[model samples]
Target: MMKPLPLDKVYRFIEPGPVVLVTTAQGKERPNVMAMSYHMVVDDGDPPLIACMLGPWDYSYRAFRATGECVIAVPTVDLAAKVVAIGNCSGADTDKFETFGLTPLPAKMVKAPLIGECLANFECRIKDDRPVENYNMFILEVVAAWVDPERKERRVIHHRGNGTFVVDGRVLDIRKKMTKWPTYIRD
Candidate 1:
């Protein structure tokens, strides 16, 4: 039995990855953050590349454009509600860090601060901006990364393209099934 799916709802099926908080700052201005779900890993090797979408509509975009750097912080399911609320509001008027009670730790390689509450934070620099004119996309290279090892809840939240969200569940390790890529398998 086949069913029809609305074109607008296709995003729910092709959801990129976990919802992340992007932090940016310029000169002496207060750092700003925005919740983002429209990002993908373009390269996974050393100093990985990530493609993220941001436009003028996003207040942080201006900072990103000015500084050419930002922090991509990965939040767990515990911060799902705050993450959604962050995306709903604009950083122009609201100090997201104060409004959301998120701690901003200094980053090693970039001016953008790292989020202390997130599972992981990737400090990145703009590598390619050719797609920014038409696609509002920027390719970023991770300059440094940080992670909280003490956090127990590691499950990530995924947006369903609406008000609804999906949380990560149990893990199913099938390393034995991956014969060709044994190098990727870990014990």
Candidate 2:
């Protein structure tokens, strides 16, 4: 059997990905927002699927579970400080949207609102919740998506270690022929 890895050392081993704002609304009340890095896009066509992990103790976790809806907002490098701030605080105690100066945009299919300042936003509905209670994981189906045209071509911000972050860097295009396996060598 494979040995189990310790949780304390797991975060670093996982690939560092972009930080996102998870917006959730329980019932008809105002939505709550939190910053998270444990998420990824699953598909690009039609209704996209997004997978994210949330701690059971997080306020947004319960809100998402209760409402079965959320919005994932991709922030830029300029918003790193604000992202850290929101991640450090609890939505249950403070009005994060107002404090962070985040504009809430109405979503077409979900109660949760999108963050206007973000470069990209994904409105999603919970497709399954069993994983959340069992492993703090959520799978969502994107109902809608938006992006700022100006920043669409620019690099987005991503979270690194120790309160540090890296912005989107230069792009490198590789020809498919150059990506062949070693055994498939060509002259």
Candidate 3:
């Protein structure tokens, strides 16, 4: 086998899963929105937490860190092209919400705005920023979350390699046996 893989490569392999829009605000001015893929649900109870990574150069980074608030918007497969467009451009140079024709809705608990077109939006406040400068990691405590009732039953879209996307389809469940098996197992 090849020698142990690099740590950076291992971390990247598990990334680019969800297609999310990271929204941030500076005071009452227009909120900036940028497409992001490095995010995950870290906890469930008592103000659910989410972890997201942002490049130090990203324009939304400072705003989010300053206000300690943001909204994670989950887009659908139909918005895949727009997501790619936003990801390709810098929010510092362009108003992505205007360019993409995405409407902004006021969030209940956070200063950031939510994408109206997204299927779900999570209003979150930064819980920790220690890892931001170190690993581009930011921990957010979800203050409020909402999902479009019409799209509640529909599958959400996820980012794949290149510009491709995969829809969340078909739920599968498998129960693990109480006894342990030494050999490897495949599903």
Report, for every candidate in turn, its global Cα lDDT versus the true structure: 0.93, 0.81, 0.81
Instruction: Give lDDT tens digits, candidate 3, residues 55-174.
Output: 867888878878888999888877878888888887788888898999999899988898999989999888988887779998889889998988754566676545667778887644
Ranked by lDDT from best down, the candidates are 1, 3, 2
Cα RMSD for candidates in order:
1.2, 5.6, 5.3
State the lDDT at 20 in candidate 3. Answer: 88
lDDT of 2 by residue, 110-134 (tens): 8889888898888888876677767
Candidate 1 Cα errors over 4 Å, as ranges? none
The candidate that achieves the highest lDDT relative to the unseen native structure: 1
| lDDT (Cα, 0-100) at 85 in candidate 3 | 84
What does the lDDT come to for candidate 2? 0.81
Span of ten consecutive residues with least summed lDDT in model 2: 178-187
Residue 158 C-alpha lDDT in model 3: 71
lDDT of 1 by residue, 54-130 (tens): 88899998999999999999999989999988998988899999999999999999999999999999999999999
Clashing pairs in 2: none
Error of 1 at 92 (Å): 1.0
Return the number of clashes found in candidate 1: 0
Give the true-structure RMSD of model 1.
1.2
